[model samples]
Target: MAQPTTSILCTDLGFDWPDGTTVLDGFHLAVGPGRTGLIGLNGAGKSTLLRLLAGELTPASGTVRVGGELGYLPQDLTLDTTQRVDEALGIRAAREALHAIESGDTDERHYAAVGDDWDVEERARATLDRLGLARLDLDRTTGELSGGEAVLLHLAALLLRRPDVLLLDEPTNNLDRHARSLLYEAVASWHGVMVIVSHDRELLQHVDQIADLRAGSVTWYGGNFADYERTVAAQQETAERLVRVAEADVQRQKRDLIEARTKLERSASYGKKRSESRNDPKIISGKLKRQAQETAGRVRGMHTERLTEAKERLTAAEEAVRDDAEIRIDLPRTAVPAGRTVLNLDHVRLPYGTRAHLELRGPERVALVGRNGSGKSTLLRAVAGEIGPLEGEISTPVPLRHLPQRLDLLDDGLTVVGNVKSYAPAADDNAIRARLARFQFRGGRADQLAGTLSGGERFRATLAALLLADPPPQLLMLDEPTNNLDLASVRQLTQALAAYRGALIVASHDLPFLRGLGITRWLELDGELRTIDPM
Candidate 1:
């Protein structure tokens, strides 16, 4: 492996949205060769930072210095549909020149075009194969490829460049299991500086380190996600202990101050009474009274200062404890009886020509796993009645709702509450807003236009709209629900699903996420759908 020629450095980096929302301020980071996973909450500027480093976006004020070549893959990657695979790989000219030379053209221009990468085609093919795109034809147009395949192709192109610094934003979002495995292998074998922003737990496990972006800053962890979690948990336990100790200290200090004040007040009262009773010498009485008042002030100040210091310590201790809130929700109305049959597919031929025979009972949680283009979304749409099956029939006994990958159920012009209201006309605005609040949209946020929401926020709004529907969907089908969600959002989704009592059939490649949901059945789809062991 080639050593890094230059490290990625950022000094006094600052960035803001067009609307003047500051995302990064005077930020600094120095990254050398090693795979680093960038994890953060939604709207943490992970993607923006990557774009700035890639030159896709300019920092407001700062320096971004890269020692060597850089390649970047954005979250939403789009290629010209008319462009051929060879062109997309960036080797069209070279490949054509090589072909001309092989045909005995003997043109000097051809040689110049080929340069030293005479085996570029072979290398490209090898790279594609490594990314599980071995069957993709170099001459084929990109229009024919699926979303996941396009991502793999783009990665192959970047790998061919042998860049010193590579950045990927949510690379595995829409990828299938096979593609994810290939990506994991690539990351494991990477020798250069790699920064990836993703919520995929499996992908994060392969990184050498984790960079947590929060509150417009980055905190580095020495190992992968699991290690990071362990370290954070340990730190949180210590913080909680400190907070408890600090609270106890504050209480003690408060009591001490009160007791001291009471004693001083009582002593002052006694001194005044004694002075009044004595009336021996005016000068002596005055001196004694002044001394008592001064002493009381001194004592009061000392106790007050100690209490203030204790309270400050308590505040600092509380600040040290992380306040990452968990999603608390209830979906009792979505429940189905244990013996209720929620769905039945009898020899149903999917749009992709594959036949599926399956039955979902009670509140069974099913995971639909397959390759990228194996019709998971298609089948999901069929079940949702968005599209009809080619043959046979699909029987859904309860109210069903489908959360598609694109989240098109929401109208961009409508507010989050308005979208929900559209779905459940009988539901009042207050009721809808209350349910939206459970999905993390509170107060004014519930009235924010769907078009203005971030990717994660949009997904949550869509989910809220679905679950908050009148009659409450008892058969929920989600297609790639975790695609653009941050780790926190993903966990929120998991928590929400945990409370849901409806039957679920989610098509996703996130194995950890599926297992977290306690899936009752594992179904794999290739040309046909079949049950598989939960490995």
Candidate 2:
């Protein structure tokens, strides 16, 4: 198979933060004309690379060359809520120019602004329609649109621009199932040079290839996410085997070195005894002793060199093995009895007009899923007692804790252990540290300030605090827990949740994650709480 044309190229790329922290140094990449899924751990420079390619950040060295026009959608899109839809789409000037021309204003400025693209409005509308925004009016303010709609609108703007190179940073983040499907369709249909930095498995499944970024470099893998996973798993298995073989070699070398040293020592002792017994001439004995010492030194040096080489090989092999830690904890105290009532909502009317009347019993794992702006977060907040319902009662017979989407419950000024201590005041320091270790924050990690943690680390720290809270929450609620998490972190969260025996209610758009949780019930909130099948 012939290689696709390289549309995005970076060579000897170097970048550093103002604090002198190096993000990328001598990094090189060549992305061809197809969808490339860029994946890496949090803070591995995936977003930074995209920004460089999009010309949002100036590189300290090297060049970024694109074959044609480029467009970028950053992870955090801050759109002015007061801006009109047309303004956000970037065609408002052209639209106004055309209107002026129609009104008999033949100013050269108007003609220049209108350019040759007379049907910009038509193209914008068609683009919006393609992205499932057919009903979105150009005259409406951005505030009128939901979060998902806003994302799609930004994408529509990029699509209308028809850039040859497109870069998307976590495009599906915070998107609902329907919006994600639309985004997936858009990605699947893209025929340009597209590089997307996302951890959304479903979105990644639509890519043409995978670019595994680590240590400021890219390793390309043919095919989509599943193919990448299979290849990486096989490679890891081989790496682990190599590490085992290296370890065995090191042990053998150590044993050989010790044996060689012992034999030399025995030989020297035997020589000394023989010399004393034989009563040889003084000069002859002295010469023989010196020769024996030289031989012994050579033997010991050879064995020592071999052992050093073996140990070096072992270290190299071990370096190839990934150390992605996982969360492991047992929370028997959080378990709920089969006949216990966890929560009850009596005709609860949320602030956003969504009404829910439900009773949660036993250790039910419930999935709360719906479109954006459907009041999923609001409902979760109401249940958590963070907000009072419009005119209803929510009762939790047992202790409950909520992990909101923003994860702001943690105090940035405090350490991970300190945060957990705040939640579990009665727990001793050693006990809290031990429990935190299970969450992968052992020793120094637990003492690091919350403000200094990466996204995944912060998530784990917050989760530990919640689960280890005093009184032990029997019912735990999480709002979009998987958002902004790397794939490994997602797996870690799944493992942690697996050990959770409490009643769980999670509001998330991640179907794969929800399915893995063994959700016993699925609920959709859209002005009314309705039982739905697990999508």
Candidate 3:
């Protein structure tokens, strides 16, 4: 394929805050055809630069240029709750198209400005049918559609806009494996310049290029995330070398300055004695003063130069590992087993106003997998003792840790630190901070409101609180622990669980995660829990 012209180009872009803090200076970037993954840590200005490209944010100075029409999908979309799935895209349009098709009217001259297509309704239905929106009821509420389905509808709407440039932020965030695959298929097949800014490594690998944002600059690494990793590794080594050399130079300068200052002090004392002596020479004292002043000036200049160099080196260090990729966080899993029979329900039904009964027991890595609305979550609540069984004796351990799927247990009003402290008030503040640090929550992030934390951070905080309890619980009940975690966190958590000795009864649809964690037993909702082969 021919290399299309640059979709967006930024030259010598400079932006600063009202408080005079510089966010970017001398930043330059160019985006082109192919899948380009834009990566950075939480606050490394990735989103800001993307906004600059999308014309949402104006540069404080310099120029941002776009070459083509753009269609952008934000990281988080607040979709229409009242409109139907089909209607969300275009209600009256689809309805009229359906009516026209039924009446066999194939005239396009009536609306010649939109398109020159011969049969307008035929074209509309064909597009909807291709996108799988043809069967959906025109009045089915958008809010009722699954997240993946809703996203597809948005894509169909964008198709109607006929954009030549597409930008996506964190696409595949809430999508399942199949849905994520479908999204990738759509992106790969698009005849446009696609630029996706996502942390999903799997998705990144599918892309043709990557633009890694660091230290107010964007560096392009061709051919996906793996290639980007190799490039970053080399760059980090070079940056570290420069930092060490600068540090050594700064230390040497400081020492020389200190020695020179000491000599000046001794010389001044000698000059004072000479003046007091009978044979004292006033000229000698004056010469001594000049010599000291010259040495001091030399030392001061060296110090100033070294300070500037040192500050630059520090910035390099900060930029080198902004997104270190080594996600630091461990979910604690104990080896101490819960006494046999962690959860048991004898002839009991679930969903007091609904249907189904459940029976369970103490088993490690029990999966409560089923279709949506299959009461898998309900069963977890019963096991957790959050809800009483309708007509059976339900038993469970008192010190069990539950990671709810919906995050309903988390109170969004509190800070991450505050939320953990709510359950472990007696725990030392220092200890709490240490726990947060283990989960990659550092700096002033502990001060950030829980209501504002990303989905992954909130879940980590909750998991840390539960796992850090003294006399660690024997039973671990996790409801979709992998829900919002990035790839790095998921891998780390998987390794952590492998080393954990405690019993795990998890509810998740991530089959690979379930299998990799060495699940020793399987629990199907409709049948008895049975032992499975452990890998």
Candidate 4:
């Protein structure tokens, strides 16, 4: 019944990159005990703000205060492969000390280490179990786990800390559906202050509030993502209406100004004619002319001022609208005939000894869905000819390209244009630049080094190169392509896919994304491929 307590606060926070690019300026936020989802377009500085709050990055100015201990899981996570689970959980030393005491070694140092945490092992196991890692052993090395399992283990360690404030950045990036469900459960059970930066709509649905970050400022929205969407849509409708009204007012004022000028011109002509005809005294005529001139000037100035104000109103109204561009390119060359066989797998022995047999015709779109460590990537690689299966006959009648989740297909040292050039050796420089522009890499942006690009930019660059390959690929395979993309980028990808007429084989855990792709077939890759209804 009581109001939740404030656990995080930032006042007049400011930060800028070393290149003098400002990200946040005079930012202010106060978060209480509840989950808050932070969302924004790519390059909106969401990660930057989280880093500042976690004390991982120093702010250029202003103060950040936390009411209690904090736990942070960054988007770019890297764990030491050789570290034991208990060590990663910050309890290995205590467990060892406890064991020594139980074995009749009563050293004071061991007793000190085991002071008040005699049940540490039990608590660790319980936390792991709660995270759906019940089968995992504390002594197991981190290298023995899958990528998604590693992410869950990291989250479990943070939960064991029991910090009052928790920060997560794209926590579901590597997690499978089951692991994502487990994470959602953990989030639902948390009573502390939680701030998560994620593009996952399902994850955002569990939050108590949404923090819309844009141009270095945060706007609060009550309720979940769907609620936020409805509210934002209403706002956009109002803004658009205002813009229309302002535009009309500007047109009206312009017409009035034109009429005023015409009247003034007529009055001046009449006055000159009267003076030339000598119809009245010179002084009286002059005085009459002066009054007419003054009236015309006032009317014209008034109309001009009204028009300027109307233009200003229109500008203000337009500012309220958001720009989320769609990819509208037509990939005609990528289209395949109805009877064309794009790919065929004849009793292929996939990784982990799973056998798969399939045939894809025309532009059939297949979505590969399954739990983590189910060999999705391995299968995709085999299809792309990046690797060969132990036993099988595979055939690809059309050019195929694979987009891996890591997006490591790009050369870090090369520019985007250079990468595209390598993929399309026959295309000239001007032609390459022109095509790159369609991918949102206009002019100088195409010159940026791949290593320095943000996640979304790198994805775009990779996509551009793949789509713009020398012969124009007729079949595309993507593995978790939306992993770290922002909402806008995901929409861009969806739009791009919608325009493609080629066959698609995409392996993704994001149901919304896969659905948006208009998948014609759903294939679950458990140990082997099996056709199933779409999720």
Candidate 5:
């Protein structure tokens, strides 16, 4: 098939980590104009590929070509906390020059700086408003902005540049529902070439196409994420059917081989008897015996070859099927009684003027959601006893564990097994290893240092440590647990939560994840907790 026109292209791209671990070898991609969602497992080199395209990382071999000016938003966008918002937006110089020109200074340098972009401030404000950041003050420092707001500000800066190609890595990682909607709108209206590496389903739904990266290769699927899923499902079905057919073919071949051997044996036995009874010459008898043996050998060889080919076909067919592993564990000890009062908060006042009066009982799953800076994290910390409520009485009748968004609970210097061991010090090494294995940390992986683990691995490690603590938690609180997790990791988390028979409270803006948790109550934290319908 003829290749489509491309604004970004990577030809035979090869890259390796400092430790010589190969990431992408001979990888090739051609992304045309329009938005493309690049998705894969956590460590499938999606981010690495973006860095290569953005010139942040050099390939070990091969070349990357981009059509025009490019703008990139990394997953970990770091802005100097002391820097002013206008400076971070890359409009401070222009704004200053315009002010000077208006103040009666006709300096050539001022005019040169404000060249053609005389309306930079107005455009900047409009862009910020479009991204749901109109409340952000340009004169204020970025340190005052929330994580989601910082991301939006960076995106706004990129928008101002109006590059021919744009790359976003997990752009909605910390965004709330409203902010994500704004981002989706921006993506929908983008006319230039764009590639976004993200696990956000809603963001993926806005893409023009889906580029699935697996095993260092890219497979193009037309339409959005839903369409890609449907196509993949159909392909898997066909692959499974082929595998069954190949398996049957192998079985038939084996049966034919057995029958051929049996028939040859019978013919040889009959011939031997006939030769003996006819009193044929010894030489003639020997020749006939040899011929019979040769015939049997050829038949056996042919049948063996047929069976081997069938098995090979089966292997190929099976290879086409995906086997994404899911986490499965039973935590019976975490179960809460039907009438048990897990937590109670009476006129609780949280940070930022948020208040709540709520009672959580039994194994109720609650989803706490709201806009950016709405204090969902503050509420979770209060429940977990990590932070005290400003003015309220909080009670927890049962033990609880909290998984914060940063996942900073684990010691980077310690191994995954060591971190778990620290949490469950009373448990023996064998017991700890056994539990960690269930979290998909088997053998050497369990010994891997927490600092070196990938985003998905880190999340799993943190979860295992929390769940396997000395006292099994009856109430589990998670704050934006899916922030940096890939889709597979999110599914794995859902599976793990499914096995936990405990009261759960998750603070997140991910409506799909919250819905999948079977939330019994939906509470929005907009200065006060109020019951809301399921999202």
Candidate 6:
């Protein structure tokens, strides 16, 4: 094996829970050169392992040895209250440090703080520029940027540290497709060992390895995301077959044990006298009969216990093996008026102080693509009736619901169930609970403060609200619905859309999904909607 430029060796890594629960098992992870995509469902010990590798959390049982420097940017980052994008990236601070260093009044202490080199300020600026944050407002404070923007700025800061190992947990969670592209390119060109946990299948394809964590152990898969899927599918099929075989064996063992005991069942033909003799026990004949009965009972009990234990063992073994992902969703019926133009905006020009005009129509399932702030959301809002155009009018002659890019539809303070209730009040709790279950948000999860839910859960909850509404929106308008979703969720959502009959106006950057869905038409940010000619 060629020595990795950077690597971390984790042996039997484990972590305990607050309630003496073991969240991380004897998980062994070998992180090395190139990109590695770490993935797991919500409570699956993925984040815990990432924290261990980053040194933020220590293992309860194992040693973590890092071969080189490591930089980490968590999915959720807390910035200094008054920090600006530029300051967070160390650009402005670096400049200030330099000014103080050059104006030195023989103060060696200050010089050492900024790295013995006076040119460090220049390097900071160069790094910030490479991160596309060169034009950031240094004094204005990060409170001005959106969640997605804040994530990017902090990522730039970590990159500034230039660690040999780079770890980003769900880095693309809140970013738009364009922003995600920025990450994709950066990770591809990065030379250090990079470990990432993202829900984007396309993003996972960029990695060199896939690690599946389950049942307290780690299974390593070579190759990228696509390769892993095929292998996993085959493995799941075999596992299911094995489960059936094990079950059959357990049943067969139970029958054999029962039959063996039945054979040992003594005949009662010795009559009541023999039976009474066994009961009396003082007579020799009675003693012999009692001994035989006692031996037979013991033998049967032993056989039963062993078979029962075998059955239990088989059950545990079956569960320990990996299974198929749960992807079934039941979206309630919503009627899209047949043979009618759902949305129409002819010679529709956007109002003053915004992006240009365009002629478009509803009942059109098309993607909206453009660079960030090139007016994708602005146009979407116009279609959603949140904004009015100065130059022309947009007529929505059909029932429609829009899932925005920023997910601004939500008010942060409500609980998951409460927010969902706001959309469909008349839905009895059971019906609502069922809908939430389909989206993987039910029970205490639905009771959790929506604000506390992770990016993915929040997005999913929002989707549940939209699709499970009273009448369900026939025409669905979504703004980058894939932003916070992991690759599995994205795939599931895509599968759901595949079966949808209503008109869809979506804005997404997942090219594979776009092509897979055979999206027939699209509108660009410049008020241009083009149809892909059918072959």
Give me the displacement of residue 28 in model 6, in angstroms.
Answer: 5.4
Per-residue lDDT value at 141 in model 6: 81
RMSD to truth, every model: 2.6, 2.4, 6.0, 2.7, 3.0, 5.7
Most TM-score-accurate candidate:
2
Candidate 2 C-alpha lDDT tens digits along 1-535: 9855649889999999998989999989888889999998888999989999988999999999988889999999888999999999999999999999999999999999989989998998889988889998888889878777888999999998889999999999989998899999999999989999998999999999999898888889999999999998998899999999999999999999899988988998999889989998899899989999999999988999999999999899888888778787899999999989999999988887899999999999999998898999999888888899988899999999999999898999999999999999999999999999899888799899999898888999999999999989999999999899989899999999999999999999988899999999999988999998767
- Per residue, candidate 3 scores C-alpha lDDT tens digits across 295-411 of 767776776677677767767665664354343544444554344656556666777332334433444666656433456667778777888766667666536777786766667
lDDT rank order:
5, 2, 1, 4, 6, 3
lDDT of 5 by residue, 1-535 (tens): 9754549989999999999999999989988899999999989999999999999999999999998889999999888999998999999999999999999999999999999999999999999999988988888888888888899999999999999999999999989899999999999999989999988888899998999899999999999999998999899999999999999999999999999999999999999999999999999999999999999999999999999999999999989988666787889999999899999999999878999999988999999999888888888888888899889899999989989888899999999999998988899988888888889999999999999998889999999998988799999999998887888899999999998899999998888888899999999989889999988
**lDDT (C-alpha, whole model) for all candidates:** 0.90, 0.92, 0.67, 0.90, 0.92, 0.72
The list of candidate 2 runs beyond 4 A from truth reads: 1-6, 100-111
- Superposed by TM-score, candidate 4 places the C-alpha of residue 307 at a distance from the truth, in angstroms, of 1.1
All candidates' TM-scores?
Answer: 0.93, 0.95, 0.70, 0.92, 0.92, 0.74
Residue 24, model 4: lDDT of 88
**Cα-based lDDT at residue 459, candidate 3:** 64
Q: Spell out the clash pairs found in candidate 3.
A: 334-502, 335-501, 415-450
lDDT of 4 by residue, 92-207 (tens): 99999999999999999999998899999999999999889999888888888887888888999899888999999999998999999999999988898999999998898899
lDDT of 6 by residue, 1-535 (tens): 9865578788877799776878876667777788888876555777777888888887889788888888888876777757765578765655566677677744665655566556765665665566665666556687766666777788777776778888888887656666877777777778878888877777888998887766666688899989999988887777777778778878887887878676765443354366575565457655666777787787778878878877886787688565424446755476455576777775566643444444334345677665555566777788888888776677777667888867666667988788888998898777777777777775888788777776667777777788777767777888877765666667767766765667787877666666666576766664444444431
lDDT for 79 in candidate 5 is 83
| Residue pairs with backbone overlap in model 1 | none
Kindly give the stretch of ten consecutive residues in candidate 3 with the minimal lDDT sum: 526-535
3 or 5: which has the higher lDDT?
5
